[model samples]
Target: MSMSVPVVGNFRQVPEVAQAGCRITERPENDLTDYAQLLDVIDVGICAVDRTLCIRSWNAFMAAHSGYGSREVIGRPLFELFPELPQDWLKERFDRVFDLGVPSFTSWEQRRYLFSFPHNCPINGGVESMQQDTRLLPIKDELGRVVQVLVCLFDVTDAVLLHHRLAETIQVLEEERQEQQQLIARLAETQEQLIQSEKLAAIGQLAAGVAHEINNPVGFVMSNFRSLEHYVEGAFTLIELFDRHIDVLPAEARAQVARLKQDMDYEFVANDVRALVAESRDGLERVKRIVSDLRDFSRVGETDWQWANVHACLDSTLNVVMNEIKYKAKVVKAYGDLPEIECMPFQLNQVFLNLLVNAAQSIRERGTITLRTRTEDDHVCIEIEDTGAGMTPEVMKRIFDPFYTTKPVGKGTGLGLSVTQSIIGRHQGSISVASTPGLGTTFTLQLPQRHTTAM
Candidate 1:
């Protein structure tokens, strides 16, 4: 005989089970009993509740975890058997499933567990109870009217635990990546500083050598010029005395002397000789001053910190770079009374040179570079202002970054401002720039009157 059996979400007819040790070719009449036996051995937690919330069916997985046999839970109200379950919430879910004849799902992420079963696995020690993902499946009869709701529970404790571990691992890796980026930035700054120091040292040596070579010839030239001036004065005095006594000479002799004087342009020659001597002397003095300025600006072997006149430093550096600026822009120095400050003079000179050259180069045509210096409290403030092709906001933001420049390639190394900033920092000072596109730029420097340990 064939019989009907209710299994999970569907109803089916099947042949009944045969008696043990007997082979029967025809169908038996106990199919529902066979279906019930099949449901008991399944691994998942399977249960069905009716419209009144009474348990209609329970499987072995449910009995094993809840410690309640099928006979104990079957026919009992589901809430009565497990008082820990959220009664109103679960009832609402069941009502929705029954009314809609549809399925609903809940995962471990939203709601951890439904049944409150103890964790069965030994390795997931971090979790105290089993995590579950549940499905509410509606069951209907022949007319397609919803009768009961089947609840299927899946054990997802391991997946949830693994997810937590993976999140922690990712957090640690992200922190490490940020640390490495910071380290790389510091290393690049150190490398740029080293390169700038080497270049400054080489330039200082060359300046010192040139100054020494020029000083000797300039000294002797000035001395000989002074003696030549005296000799010319005596000769002109004797010529004046002879002119006063010219009436004492014979007629022929006097005529010969007159012809010689006219031919030689004697008065013009004497006057031009004195003027030429004055001009040559002035030129030599300028050469001598340039050599002296070069020596002061470089201070090659004077790397040790010492008390230096700030005005003197600026003047020497300005002279050293005069050729670069004289044609491009007019420099106006507004000096203020400032006390000597302790510093590495050569390094400070480099800073001045860099800023001045940059100010001059910024001007496309003739412009003004005004240098103003003054003492304010314990600091010396210097401003190098230029009426030049100023920078945009974007360019100003990155002007101090190493190898960042707007100058044409091959004309600039882009490290000038970067190295300039570094030098100022080494003296425990600060440098800042203010620029307006198409207007001009001003670089302001503040140096402490007293030296302190550099950062």
Candidate 2:
């Protein structure tokens, strides 16, 4: 018969062995050690099937893992013991592996085929009750004809579960990092907006002071012009009478009356008449220019972009704040030749206004504020320097934070430098400051020469 004795010498110790292939070798001595004892052993299940898919070899590990004994599984169609598996499909692959001398496998797909637990295998029962990795390996006969199929199994549920858990944790951390970045960006923008609002508030307060200051000087100058107009009418009347009476007078009297008069008392009445007209006209013109500049500088959020003259904006802001600096500080300007830069004119005007005011305020008294500008290859450089009480490192570090004030509660909101930095950065430019506590401070702003976006 083709059936043969087990290869292991101590055969009785093993639960079962599958005779999947034709055994062709001559029998060895009974005293020789056999295959089962020579190999490591486990309690997990194993099985073998013939060409018709009937169970052949059933090992102790298979019996223990499957909770099925050899007696119940052997000689039975393998599918009858585990109906949960795709029986016909598994059978086809198994058949093909043997036919093609290839191997086949299955797992996870069928959790419970015979029993729920390996420990549940019947005593003489096999270990086929646990989670499994079943395979079909081809066996060849001496003539190379296919003979049987071998199947093996393992318990991998724990490993599969751990892999899934690790994947989930990684996903959670990445999501958190992204959220934090977005939050940081949002917080920075909000802080910048708040700083700008405070600066605008300070400007409003300064504007009130400016209005009060200008009104007094303006009222008198305007009155002076009005008075001078009436005086001109009187002077003209006197001249007409002199002209009419001139012909009757001799040549000597006419020459004296007609001679050109100097304002420094060459001819008193004529000089007084000329001086009043000239001074009043000049005063009115000066007042008109100052008012126009104030309006330009204070105009709010101009969204439209234009080729704007930054120099003109600076001139306007400086004029508006002239009264503030005039008494305490002297402004020294080193304006350079420049091209018209494109931007939101009114917004840039606000920037200039902030910078100039800061420069003026930096000085305690009787100091100099230097305003300078230059153009490099692709950028415009503006430097504002003041000889005033400069900053310490501690103050500079906290200067950009909102509401961090160094000035006493009313005089400063401490938002000016922060706002200046934000505006410059928004324009794709950079701003930096250098200071020495007792010497002075310099704020340098660098802007791109050409902007792609319309400000």
Candidate 3:
């Protein structure tokens, strides 16, 4: 006997499925019989429901999985037979198919299964139930009206499990890649820091040698200068006594001596000698002060923490880099009362040198670099501000990152600020920066007054 069977097709007449190029078709009675047999024998679950949600057809796959034979489920309300289904949501899907005469689909990703059938594979034991990919196709009558909706359930439990496993594997791989990148970055930073430390050590040694050599010559020169000043003063006094005794000489002799004195320009020489001596003394003193500043700044072999004056450290650092700054910017010292702070003096000097040199380099033309210092409770606050070409927000964000630089290739190694920050951290201190593009930039350092072992 021939029975009605739904034929799957591209429902092109339905507005929603038109773009999808789908339409339902009818078959002869003999062909319908063959189709029904094909549906019953197939592994997929096939069933049909009418407008009142009554089951009209049930296939072998549905009967086997649901444990309800065709005779028992047919003509029964679908919701009554399988009350575990999402009645409202599933009804809406069926209603749309019936009214539009189009097919609707739900993947296993969207919903695990339409019916609670345990998965058949014992190997994939992680899944508790069968995962299904479901579809609803409209069954049309001869007059082109939707009489019922055909539901097809595909067991996609394996595919769903594989997808979840793939996603988990990908997530694990991504996390590993991120960790490797972070490790590589940290290694690069550590290497750069080591190189910088070696360079600083070499520089300190060189500075110590130079300071020692200069001190010897300076010491003797200063001693000789004192002796020369004494002799010159004695000669000047003798000349004054000679001038007072000129009245006792013969008039012709006195006239002769006056003429000789005028020819020698003795009075001018006496006055000029004092002026020359004063200027020489001042120059020597300046040299001595510079040498002293250099020695203090280098502090080779002085790595242990010690009580140091912050202002003194800054001044010594400024003196060491004065040549670099003098040509590019004018320096202004706005000092305030500050107490001694325990720190690595040479390292602090390095920090100040880096900041001061950076401030000088930032100015393309002549500008002012102002050094300000003050006491803030238990900390000494120092600020190096420059009226130069300042940084953009983006540049400022990465300024302390190792090996990140905006300067010309050879002009910067990009480790200066990074090293400066490390030194501050070692001192149990903090450094912060503020900048405006056209106006200027300021780097403030706050160092604690006492050293802590945690640092």
Better of 1 and 2 by TM-score: 1
Question: Global lDDT of each model?
Answer: 0.82, 0.68, 0.84
lDDT per residue, candidate 2, 13-113, as tens digits?
22222243323244344645443432226544556678888887676666655567777887998887877667667767887877787777666654433
**Candidate 1 lDDT tens digits, 1-455:** 22112334433343322111011233344434454456566666888887888887788789999999878987899999899887888889999998998889989888899999987884644787888999988776546667777898888888878887887888899899899888898788778767766777788779889899999989998899899989989988998899999999999999999999899998799899989988998999889989998887667436578899988889888888999999999999999899999888877887889898999999998999999999999999999999999999999999998888888988777888987887788788899999998999999999998887744
Query: How does each model score on TM-score?
Result: 0.62, 0.48, 0.62
Give the distance in Å from residue 86's predicted Cα in candidate 3 to where it truly belongs: 22
lDDT by residue (228-337, candidate 3, tens digit) is 99999999999899899889999999999989989989789889999999999998988898888777766744679998888888888887899899999989999999
**Candidate 1 overall Cα lDDT vs. reference?**
0.82
TM-score of 3: 0.62
Worst 10 residues of 1 by lDDT: 15-24
